[model samples]
Target: MEKTWWKESVVYQVYPRSFMDSNGDGIGDLKGILLKLDYLQELGVDVIWLSPVYKSPNDDNGYDISDYQSIMTEFGTMDDFNRLLSAVHERGMKIMMDLVVNHTSDEHPWFLASRSSVDDPKRDYYIWRPGKDGKEPNNWESVFKGSAWKYDEGTDEYYLHLFSQKQPDLNWENPQLREEIYSMMKWWLDKGVDGFRMDVINFLSKDQRYMDGNILDGKQHGDGSPYFLNGPRIHEFLQEVNQRVLSDYDVMTVGEMPGVSPDDAVLYTGEDRGELHMVFQFEHMDIGGGPEGKWNNEKWDLSDLKGILSKWQYRLEEVGWNSLYWNNHDQPRVVSRFGDDGEYRVESAKMLAACLHMLKGTPYIYQGEELGMTNIAFESIEEYRDIETMNSYEELVNTYGWPKEKMMAAIHARSRDNARTPMQWNDGRNAGFTTGTPWIGVNANYPEINAEKAYNDHQSIFHFYKKLIQLRKQHDIIVYGRFDLLCPDDEQIFAYTRTLGEEKVLVLCNFKGQEATLTIPTELHSLKATLLIGNYEQEESDTVSSEPLRPYECRVYLLK
Candidate 1:
């Protein structure tokens, strides 16, 4: 397998708004990130994948970009961003900015111009259509809630918005618009930004037929995913961007692609494809969602998760690359979702980290995940800040007449705000995040799970992640080894092996709280096994025993 800097490197994602607050503004800024550069460097991450810090109206929490070139005033000035970039590079680390080009804020200059009048020169910059049958342009639903089309009084034409009405979808079919985007990207690359994490990249190219999507049962609006996701012209647009801008830079690029299969991933990130280095697929992220979507509380099966992960590993082993992650800015805490977040939060967090870091892909660690931060259950709806969560509450309780408690329960389990809470730095007020009031309430358990506490503990999840990253840097087998699943049917034990020539490593993870015995494959019983790393204390070090794994026990064995 071919090797690259990005493939061998571990990325740490920093949601600036919640990471660290500077100037007592109750919001995380570039200076806040600068204050924690040493923290990130000590964590042994090679790249810092920053979420959108561009100028925005915060309609979608910075996903709705109003200006591509300017830094968000809340985040700080361009000079502050420059200083942060230099500091990161000086520490021998790369910083990747989030590229949210699938759509722009309604307040964006281009969108404003496009919506001003039907005859505006930039009118074609956005997707707009006349009302159909005295209603919306289509039956499509906004991802947050309500109709996807927002009617404009000035032009009397409805504009498409896949997300919130404030975030209008861009028309990728326009060559002029594409050029403007490419130029903006080049400008950033020229400014010494290492790379980009493209947001919802697959949603850029939509089916021009403007066809109606199939409506699910009891749903008012149709699912427009089929008409927009991974559209026909996606490859053309990606290749054009690559040829025009990306090809000239030696930077990492990972596209956030939802509704993408392994086959589509292969086409997007093939070695010779000249499109992207890798893509973040949402198949694993959607494990627990039910037919009613993310709001429902559905228990995910371990075997099903193993099947999905194994499929991606096997399929991408030869062609495209994979970006491994358990949770991000958009998902709930992994320890709470998939592991024991109560009695064994630390153990489960370490296990989850080991499981993901051992995979043959670039692993992304979301902010505060290293400290084993769990989800929060705010007592009142007024305490919540996410637009999606608020919309869901209104739609389910007010419109559908679902119990408020049921909706709140779903929010506790699945809300993106769970991940957006302020990072816990210490046990002090505001979790040492800010002196002033935080924009979103800090997790109440911050006193126990703060970074200061984790950094001081040797057996903490934070140190375990540092070791995992160091091992990735030390061993090539972990980066390029061919993966093979062991005991595929076992629901309790998640086990796999990575083999590179004569070197081999086996990883075992116990998903449940009970002890489970692992059946060692008889063919490799003779090989000497050295305990590389494990969450629990070790007694026997040089043998691969068929001993039952402890609750949330994860161990990596180096066999020779």
Candidate 2:
């Protein structure tokens, strides 16, 4: 496989609104990020991926961009952004901005012009179609719930918005719009921004047929994802992006692609594809969801998680690269989702980190994940702040007549707001995130899980993550090594090996809360090994043994 800096580096994602609050504005700003530069540097991350900070109405929490060039007032001014960029570069770390070109805020100038009238020149800048028999243009449902097409009386036509009405999908078929996006990307690159995390990039191209999707929940409209996700023109548009703007700069780019398969991922990230450095696939994230979608209360099988991750690991080993992550701004906390977040939070967090970091990809750590933050339990629906969560709640409760307790249970397990709670810095009021009223309530368990406590504790999850990052920099095998999974059928343990030349490293992770025996293969049992790093501080024998691993224990050994 080809080598790249991004492949060898670890990325840290920060949701600016939840990261920190400065000036007591009840919101996190760019200057607050500047104040935490030393914190990130100490964590040893190579790249920082900042969520959307562009000018927005905050309808979808900055995903609905009103201006590509201006910074959101809630996030401070353009000067603050410039200083933050310079500070990150001076600290020897790269900063990546969120690129939400798949859609723009309805308040955006382009959308304002496109919605003026049917005959307007900018009308073609967005997807607009006449209603079909007094209904929507097609039987498509928005991701946030409801018809995908919204009727505009001014133009007497319908516009497509896959997410929310406030976020109108852009017309990628329009050459002028594509040029505008590329030009904006170049402007940021020229301003010293390192790269971009393109949001829902696969949804940029549509089928154009506007066919009705299969009805699933007996709702009038159906999920329109199949027609838009990874559409026919996705490759062409991405190649255009690569050739026009990305080719000129040596910056990393990772596309947020949902519903992408391993076969398609090869084309997207192939060494010569000229598309993206890597793509974030959601197969593993969707393992726990059922036919009803992510909010469904279903148990996730450990083997299923192993199968999904291993498939991508093996498929992309040679053809392309992978982007390994468990949590992000859009997903719930990892410890709560995958591991035992109650009694074994610290150990399971370290084990989960070791499992993904040992894979052949760039590891991404979401904000507060290094401290083993778990999902929050809001007492009532009013405490929820995510548009997606609120919409789903209303639909499930009022439309379907589902019990309020059941819907709230789903929200507790899957709401994006679970990840949007303020960063717990200390055990002070509002978790020391802000002196004033926080936009969202801080997690009530902040006293036990704050960063100040973790930093002071030598054996905390934060220090384990620091060691993992240090290991990646110290050993080249961790970056370019070939990966091989061992005991693939084991439901309780995850074991893998990374080999580069004569050097090899063995990684073992126990996913359960009971003692699990790791039987070494007979052929490899005699080899001598040295303990490289582990969550527990112990010197085991020099060779493999039939000893049982403790609950959520993670150990890495250097094979000789």
Q: How many residue pairs clash in all the candidates, one count each?
A: 0, 0
- TM-score, candidate 2, is 0.99
Query: What lDDT score belongs to each candidate, Candidate 1 first?
Result: 0.93, 0.91
lDDT value, residue 382 of candidate 2: 98
Candidate 2, residue 16: how far the Cα is off, in Å:
0.4
What is the per-residue lDDT of model 1 for residues 185-254, given as tens digits with 9 covering 90 to 100? Answer: 9999999999999999999999998888888887888989999999989999999999999999999999
**lDDT at residue 117 of model 1 (Cα atoms):** 87
Off by over 4 Å in 2: none
Task: Single out the weakest 10-residue window by summed lDDT for candidate 2.
Answer: 537-546
Model 2, range 473-508, lDDT digits (tens) per residue?
999999989888898889999998999998788899
Error of 2 at 230 (Å): 0.9
In angstroms, how far off is 118's CA in candidate 1? 0.9
Residue-pair clashes, model 1: 0
Once model 2 is optimally superposed onto the true structure by TM-score, how far is the C-alpha of residue 18 displaced, in angstroms?
0.5
Among all candidates shown, the one with the greatest lDDT? 1
**By TM-score, how accurate is candidate 1?**
0.99
